[model samples]
Target chain A: MTEPLFDRVALIGIGLIGSSLALNIRANGLARHIAVTTRRRETLEKAEALGLGDSYHLEATEAVADADFVILCVPVGVCGAITSEIAPHLKKGAIVSDVGSVKGAVIDQMRPHLPEGVDFVPAHPLAGTEQSGPESGFLELFRNRWCILTPPEGTDPAAIEKVEAFWRGCGSNVETMTAEHHDLVLAIVSHVPHLIAYNIVGTAADLETVTQSEVVKFSASGFRDFTRIAASDPTMWRDVFLTNRDAVLEMLARFSEDLASLQRAIRWGDGDTLFDLFTRTRAIRRNVIEAGQDTAKPNFGREPGNGEAAPGESTGS
Target chain B: MTEPLFDRVALIGIGLIGSSLALNIRANGLARHIAVTTRRRETLEKAEALGLGDSYHLEATEAVADADFVILCVPVGVCGAITSEIAPHLKKGAIVSDVGSVKGAVIDQMRPHLPEGVDFVPAHPLAGTEQSGPESGFLELFRNRWCILTPPEGTDPAAIEKVEAFWRGCGSNVETMTAEHHDLVLAIVSHVPHLIAYNIVGTAADLETVTQSEVVKFSASGFRDFTRIAASDPTMWRDVFLTNRDAVLEMLARFSEDLASLQRAIRWGDGDTLFDLFTRTRAIRRNVIEAGQDTAKPNFGREPGNGEAAPGESTGS
Candidate 1:
């Protein structure tokens, strides 16, 4: 067997990403020991029941004892507090990271509290399904998907490389960008898109002219597509918006301005404007397909009788 | 073999729906003969090459001659002129229908031009994919999907029943509603969703700060979901907006108002407000799943390794 990459790996907050990493670690022998910790006793017991970790701890400090690597897999809102809680317990030169969607806030909240010797290499896996909880993850979730690392400048290069190798072992293509760029990129690609989805679904759900039953009965197209993303973990999404507020707001303004013009075009019978925008947007879809970010299957490869395999992390983390 | 449902079936446009109907009719022995026609000689030649029809005609009048059933599988914008052109050639007592998304406009467009002895039933098969044309059609495109018929008041019940049976033969469950209600229902469910999807994709494409390549490379979640629908046929979608103007505008107003409030909530850090809407939308997804209108599998049953069959018609007609 290949030598283990680390003596121990500590995972705080054993949810979907955490559990999946636990599985990956065990399957690949990435760590000689796996320690899982969560605030809730019930969740810790559940992780223990699933045999997801070699050691389980209700206390974060206990979980991080002698650990050479620590990854926080909790909601972004708690990252600062959790980092403070685990800071002193981290072993010297231990690499620390996270799987939050918003990187700028995650870095701001996490890095300040991390101990001097520990390397804080912030990570954001652009991979997830609508489902949450520990049971929702699988080994293939990160396969052929992007896992972005936004390690602060002048941090340990060796630490960043090790984390990249670990993610690659979990079947992800590694990407590196600044925390600022990551937040900006994620705001347009994931955050604002999710906000609008949630908004449209709310609008459809509350309309007096259209009953919810009618909405459900005839949800054949675009509405149902939004619903999947809207159905993502509410708390996590709220944290996402709260953390990445400025970037999301900027993107939202742009989206609203564009939508207003489209609305005006419809009012004035400007079919050419609509047609031009529609045609131009298609080239981007082609680019995404060629970049292997999505499936070439029509309707996300979902509507076909003999369906193609859908691309991973369809909505967001 | 089972007795044919009709002596002859004429498909006035051999596009996705028409070719699929042709396959369904051939597979299930629903019609003795299929006559296909389109304005474009190239399209008719393509239909001929595929052997999709017993007879292919460049002239709509020739296709409708002696045909007991005629389906206008064309865009909503051209229904009126085409109906007037083919009016004199329609056989007496023949059932004529369409597969346009907007029923009220379609009825208003086509009914006045039809002959007295012919029955006009405006139908909408709530099905389609991003891909278009005759080549994209498949036998199971309408399987277990809804086909709503909006027959005008005082129309012949026998003709309506016959049209309903034809949709059933094509493996769709038929629903009947007034043209007005159908337009209203579709406005909230499909039309507005499509407008917003198209709008967002346009917005993302035109951003100066974020490059198009960045959008495509990081296109994993909500943005990618929209690119699929935004990638849908520009002409067909343009027609849908042009013909179904009022209802779409009404729904668009609701969506924008809700989005504005959501934008305010994000700006104000109203986590509870965001959380409540996010939680409420999940139930609609469950109801849509229970109604058999969509798949229960997470991410439209996509993102899973062994994916569930994604429900058909993920985007609008």
Candidate 2:
């Protein structure tokens, strides 16, 4: 294994991203010690039981004490408070970072609280699953995924390099951009897509004529994909939308405008418009597959099983 | 081997669904002879090259001649014309069915063209991949997927039973519903979802600040799942939205209303509203996975690969 990059690395939360980071650090020997802290004692106990860190603490200050690398792994809404709690306890030369989805808001929240001499860099590893909690994380979660760093202007180059090296060690490609640009890009790519998914699933769930059970039964038709995205961590997504409001709203507006046009096309039977848009979108999937961001296997590589019980066999009426 | 369900099966299209049906029919001995036909000579040649049928014909009437079962596997928009083309050549008491996405429209279109004594049952197998064409099909595509039949009222019961049994033989569970209900259910589950995906991908592509390359590079963050759905057969989806206009528009209106409320939540910083919706949608995903419609694997079971090139290493400037 490579030489340890940090003597003591403290994680401020132990959810999916944190637990995965802890496992990655241990597996890659990226840190000599990992200290994990969470608000809930049960979560701390679960992290310890899972061997996510060498030391567990209920207090953020305790976790950050003597730590050279402190990564805030909580929801974006809580990152500021966590930073305020742990700021005074951090080592003088510690490199402070985060794994929040909304980088600009995260940076704004944490930058003022950080003590002098400590480097603050906001990072977002564009990887996760629908499952959450400490048990949901895996060692290879970051493999081949992007870890975007939105370092504030004039931040220490050495600190950014170390953080970049850390992500590379954990098998993530690194890209640096201004936090504003990052938020806009993520708004279109992540935030709005998720919002639309949550919205559609909610719509389907709320339908009177189409029962929820029927929706679930026929989900393989296309609705199931949206459900997976809509199933993402609620608190984290809430913070994402709240903190990245302007960008998400902007993207949603554009999405709504485009959707209205499409709706009209359907109404007027403008098959050409629908066909052109559909064909154009097909190329993006190909690009994503070629870029190594997604799989090329059919149906997202889902395994075949016996089809759901036949209608006559299961219908009770 | 099981008894042959029919003496001859005629497939009027040789795309993904048609070819997969052809393969499934041969593997299960569902038909003594599989006759394939397509409007394009190239598709017929490709199906022949893949050995997808025993007899290949360029003309729909030629393929349906003396056939016991004629499945119109083309887009919903073309079902009526194709049915009219093959109606005169169909054997007496021949079962005419289709694998179209929009059932109500398909039944409306084809029911009038089918001659007396010919059975017209509209079937939609809720299974497919983003890829299309004869080469993209496999024998197992229909395994574990639901096939819904929307036969018109007073249709021959024996013909309906045969169609249901045919789907079961192809490894699909069978359900029967009215054509109107089928269209509404599918409008929510398939058509609107596809329309939104296509719209969002178009929106992302048209962004000024967020370049197309950036969207492509960072698509793994939820946007890529949509691209897969958006990549589906454009001609098929266009026809679906066109024919299922009323249901799709209804669903879209509901979706837009829900999205407006969500947008307000985000704008007002109402985290609880966002959180509640996100949490509620999660249960649907669990149900879908348990129902055997989707996989539980993280990131849709994408395989691990080497991370993209390190940013610093790739930056020539």
Candidate 3:
């Protein structure tokens, strides 16, 4: 195999994303050594049992003592404190980055506390399941997915190139953009979608006319899709909304206005307006399918044997 | 083997649900003969090519002639016109039912036009995919799914029992309710969810800051889930919103109020409230999975080989 990309890489929090990164690094020989740490002892022990890293440390500073690359995998709200805790022990000229959903706030939180001469590149990988914890990860999670890197202005080009190459080696297509642009793009694509999902699920749950059991029983129609998105990691999403406040709020405002117009059309029996919007939205799904961001299989390719009849029942129908 | 439930069953508008019903009727020997009709000649031709029925016709009256069971599978808006056209040809004591998403409007539209001796039962099968057309169906589409029948009061008991048995034979768990309650329940579960999905996909497409290509490329994060629901048949959804106006409007108002509160929490950085709401929603997903309405597999069990890396890359990671 080719030489590893880094001598040692340190992960500050070995949750779903962190454990997946560790597995990918090992699978592709991207790093020679992996150091894992977490605030909770049980999580550290779980990572150790899973063989997620070559070394385990309870303290963030010890994990990054001799590491050539350090990635903070904690929630976005804790990046600043973690950066401050590990800044003293980071190897000279070591590159620092984070796997955060929100870019601008993460950079603002981590940039100042970094030691002089160390490089910082913030990234958000557009791939994940609605699962958390170390056991919920796999090496193939990042394959063919987008890893967006938001390098602040005046950063070292060599460090940015190295981070980009690292992500590519882990089987991700890399893109570079400003932190502000990244935040806005993610606000629409990720943040607001999640917010609406959470809102609808909550609304369904709190309805007096419809029982919760009925909602759960007949969810296969459409409400189940929202439930899946709403089941995402709570801590991570909480930090996402807290950090990316302005962009998410702006997108939510636009979404509310559009929804109000749709409501008006429905109340007034304006079939033309509803049909036009529904037709326009179908094109976006086609675009997403053509772009290979999702599969073309019905119901996201949910297998037939799970609850539906066996596949043999088709009989040429 | 056994005797069929009906000597002749006529299906008008052989689209996704209609074609699926035809297939189920054939697979389980629920009917001796199936007659299919559609307004479009191409769709009728496609149904004939697929052998979805024993006979195909472009006229509703021709399809339903002398049939014991006649089902209207067209959009809710067109149900009244088609019912008026087919009423004159209906056989004495024949059962007429419709598979429309909105129940009250369909009953209101079809009841007045049905012949005096015929039985009218309305149903909305809580099953479908993001696909439409005669060829996009299979025998197992209704397997283990809910099919709710909304029959008017004072209807013949024998007709309701026959319809219930027909649905049961098609592999659906059946329930009966008033048309008003069915509309309200479905508004929260199906109609409003579809409306929100269409709205968000539209909002993402119309953004000036983000290019459409970028949104499509990075959709796997959360936006892609909404796209699946948004890609549903446009005419059907338009009719659903128009016919179920009162229930849908009430649900939308509740959703908007809840969304505004969530937005306020995000603006003020209320992490506790966000965490509580997110936590509560997770339990609903669990309930859905437990109730067998959805699969518990991550990412809706989208297999890796569909577009990304091959399945062999997992290696138990």
Task: Write the number of the candidate with greater lDDT, choosing between 2 and 3.
Answer: 3
Which one wins by lDDT: 1 or 2? 2
DockQ of 3: 0.52
Could you tell me how far off, in angstroms, the CA of residue A62 lies in candidate 1 after the best superposition?
0.7
DockQ order of candidates, top first: 3, 1, 2
Question: Candidate 3: which docking quality band?
Answer: medium
* Candidate number achieving the greatest lDDT relative to the actual structure: 3
lDDT of each: 0.83, 0.85, 0.87
Candidate 3 per-residue C-alpha lDDT over A96-137 given as tens digits, one digit per residue, 9 for 90 to 100: 999999999999999999989899988877778898899988
Ranking by TM-score: 3, 2, 1
Candidate 1: list runs displaced more than 4 Å: A303-317, B303-317
Could you tell me every candidate's TM-score relative to the true structure? 0.95, 0.96, 0.97
Off by over 4 Å in 2: A305-317, B305-317
| Decoy 3 TM-score against native | 0.97
- The order by descending lDDT is 3, 2, 1
Worst 10 residues of 3 chain A by lDDT: A308-317
In terms of lDDT, the poorest run of 10 residues in model 1 chain B is B308-317
Chain B TM-score (each prediction, in order): 0.94, 0.95, 0.96
